[model samples]
Target: MEKLIDCHFHIWDLDANYYPWLTDNVSENVTKITGDYSSIRRNYLVEDFRKDIGDLNVVAAVHVQADADPKDSVKETQWLQSVADGSGNGMPQGIVARGALNADNAEEIIEAHCACPNMRGMRVEMHPGLNAPADYNPLKDEKWLRNFALLQKHDLVFEVRAASPEQTKDVIQLMRDHPETNFVFPHLALSIWRDEEAIAAWKRNIKIFGELPNAYIKLSGYGLFGLGWTTEMVRPYVMDVIDAMGPDQVVCGSNYPVDSMAAPYSRIWETHFQLLDDAGITGADRAKILHDNGKRVYKL
Candidate 1:
């Protein structure tokens, strides 16, 4: 079997700190959202992840931001870099740390994160519906354009995580505005609620994004879409994205821990395997989605 690179995995320890957003009202679809800190706080160290994959060659991994405190975001990257440096495991070769793109110190935050060896990019989470309060609208043009420019200045890949389809246009526009910046749309533009109209709108948006040479898409987080996501259930959506973006522009991501609520770690990988097999993607294409593309995107 070909080696894999899970480009969108996350690891968190609730005991270490707090994930304030983990509450009853977090998201109705996620069962683990209801669990207490202990239930959610299992040790998921780099070694644990390696053991979990067993024979599967996790040649490298890109650690996506896990919505912790902004300070903890930098700490998480440092911890992962230490692990990578000590053990020499190629997994976790890059980290996508968090920063308030709209914050006044955005450049400073990016510079601090980039100083770390494993820090490859930054994730500006745009979960407007879930995290945005009634008064807070992220669509304001000034902050949006300023944040996009910061990513370009630091030469960081921007990971856009919009919770709703309506926000896709804003993200795409940001990409268009900064033709030099590279952006990765995590979770297939994050339109996983199975809302037909929303999905359709996202498809149109993605088509436009696919034309942008600097854009990439991550095939991750199927579990977040709904409760039971078998390979067949998710295959059409995944294939449609692959068809739209082509294999070179897309990559696979495990979205682990968060995905553990819907299915165990093993099932998540198995589902990905089945989807790629059913799609008749060649081994080279599988390598690109699983490893090569991530290496290029994250510069791992």
Candidate 2:
């Protein structure tokens, strides 16, 4: 197997930490892209993750925040850092903790997260409502933008997801406003794979995002493409992202545990390899998407 660096994955201890989505009854408000998530609701420690990967040579991996309680955001980072320090596996070499950019204590929380040795960045979800106007978008809110700039000060990555056209444009503007802060777009901008028209819009928005020097995209969360999704079914979506953002700006992640609902860890990586091969991305370029870009982007 080729070397790998999983830019996205999660290892949550349900008993140790409180996760509202996983613990509380599944909310109807949550999007059901992959239908039910009953299979991955339990704790997924480093050992469990290792067992899943088995022999795959994951040189390093990033642990994106798994929606722990807002009050425990910094606690989550410290806990993961401890896990990385003790696991000896050196998995989750980086921790992308959570911080609500609009919260009054956002900067204080960010400072606490950065204090952790494994702190790399944070994923502040900008669910900019469907087709929200520039004036109404939360991302453009004065307090939020001021707090978002804290990431730049710490030289941290901002892993974001933008679903609507207006939100994508807002992200583009945000990038322009703060070029110093690196942006990693996860889950193919959380595309609506079931709709070709939505995919077309995603393509247009992704192309615009690619033009920004600070923007990067992660190819992950195939499970979100819907249950029983084929490699062929999602190949065009993958290719379009690469076409827009080149190998250098793109990175790959398992979106594991969550994606485990769709397929095994090995199968997930195999699908990623197949998708890249289908796109004719081989040699160093292939290495870039697989692990190199991840190493550089996450400083693993």
Candidate 3:
């Protein structure tokens, strides 16, 4: 198997700022935030990545935006890129920095981020549960289109996270409208929480969007949906996504830090291996999902 390129890892220091979502008390049966940056510092940097990867290779990595201060987003990208450049660990490959694409001056926000050499894309957190209601509708708002157009102008990929199936369609439509813009749908549209009917609908919509050459999906974050902490439980969902989207267009993501709350980093990696093994995918295809596709998408 090819060494994996974790496309969706998150790095943060809670001491620096408040992560409102990482609540101290848990009303729901959600995973407790570990708030550990030691392992990242110790394990994820260039030397650590090489050690963990061993003979396996990491072609590139795309840093998915963490929900932090917008200013910190750019700063984090800069730091990661510097680490990559200094360590010769692939130059962070590509950065999906955070931005409020629905805001009035969204275009300017994107341009400012695009100015960074490592910034290859923008990750807009459109989770209606976390963001304003208006952001959920990218096509409905003129400003969102303007921001999207700016991304197209810069040739930056669009990484989107949506909480609902309907929102997936809205994003697909937006991508269709701007055929030139590349769209990466992270966490399988966050569909693991959906009922059977909803899953079917999402699958159908995903198939529709899969026809679009510019659209891609990241196979990450399925573990967050279930209370159970096993790779086996997540297999069916991951397999269903791979079968629907196919391996070439799909890439692996750890969704770390957030995912670490439920399972350790090692378990997360194991779960991905289990999914690929169960699917009986070839080494080349596995390599694509593991790293190459991400390299291509991020231009790393």
Candidate 4:
């Protein structure tokens, strides 16, 4: 059996009233942080995750923010710590909670999450495709950058997602501007490798992040764009990401529950390994992607 740190997975309780997007009335497709997600309406908790990753030899797991109300983001981390305390499963050793980098209360929220023994960092999702109000456009604002810099002071990581490669380019300055705070870019930064122009631009964007030692990228969410991702579809892009970021800077995440909608948990890991194997990623280097990188980056 292979051991892993499983950098990403999500567990939510519909009974908690924390997740607005998980409302039971979601009979049709609903847009959460990711995209049009209709299949994940059901409540998913720690036990459900255990079942999904059954016998996969996960040494630990990192729980990223699950789009719960921002007010309850700290509480969400507390609840997950409780889950970890009781699960006896040796999972959820780290958490990436939510906090608006542009908010006046950003430091308060960041400090609150930092108090949690398991909290690793914070993430903000800017969905430019939806024209998310004036507030979501804080990436370039001085106040947002000021609040964002607080992550370094507290030794916390920053994870972000932009709607397009062009938007990703806009973050390059932020990464270089904040060298002390580490950043994690997930899902090939939503690169559409099938298109030549998009892939070329994505490579350029990725290369910029690669130059910044603090920036990291997660090799997950291969099918996030509703196209039903396959290894063939994701290989060139994944390899390109590795080429830019190198194995040590790359971490692999299951993006479970959300990714499970497109492919089962086991299948997702299986195909990801196949991609690595084909790319000639060494076994030791493979261990870094599957486990060490996550443990070191997340400080699990």
Best by lDDT: 2
Q: What clash count does candidate 3 reach?
A: 0
**Winning candidate number (TM-score):** 2
lDDT of 3 at 195: 76
Ranked by TM-score, top first: 2, 4, 1, 3
What would the TM-scores of all predictions be?
0.87, 0.93, 0.81, 0.90
Score candidate 1 by lDDT. Answer: 0.72
Runs of candidate 4 with Cα error greater than 4 angstroms are 24-36, 88-90, 134-136, 191-196, 225-227
What are the per-residue Cα lDDT tens digits for candidate 3 across 23-104?
2333122222233433333123445444544454555566776655554555656666666577645646678888676777
Off by over 4 Å in 2: 128-136, 192-194
Clashes of each: 1, 0, 0, 0
Query: lDDT tens digits, residues 1-300, model 1?
Result: 677788888766555545555423443433333233334445566666677667877778888877666555667666666666876365578888886767777677777788887887887756554455555556564775666687778778888765466566677777778887788887766554567787778777777877887889888887765656677777777888887787788888878766766777777777777777778877788778777888888888
Clashing residue pairs in candidate 1, if any? 5-290
Reference-based TM-score, model 1: 0.87
The root-mean-square deviation over C-alpha atoms between each candidate and the true structure, in angstroms, is 2.9, 2.6, 4.2, 2.6
lDDT per residue as tens, model 4, 28-142: 3245444667678778888898898887888888998887775667788778877878773546899888867777888888888888788888877665443247445666568
By lDDT, the better pick of 1 and 2 is 2
Cα error, candidate 3, residue 171 (Å): 1.9
lDDT, model 2, position 130: 23
Q: Which pairs of residues have clashing backbones in candidate 3?
A: none
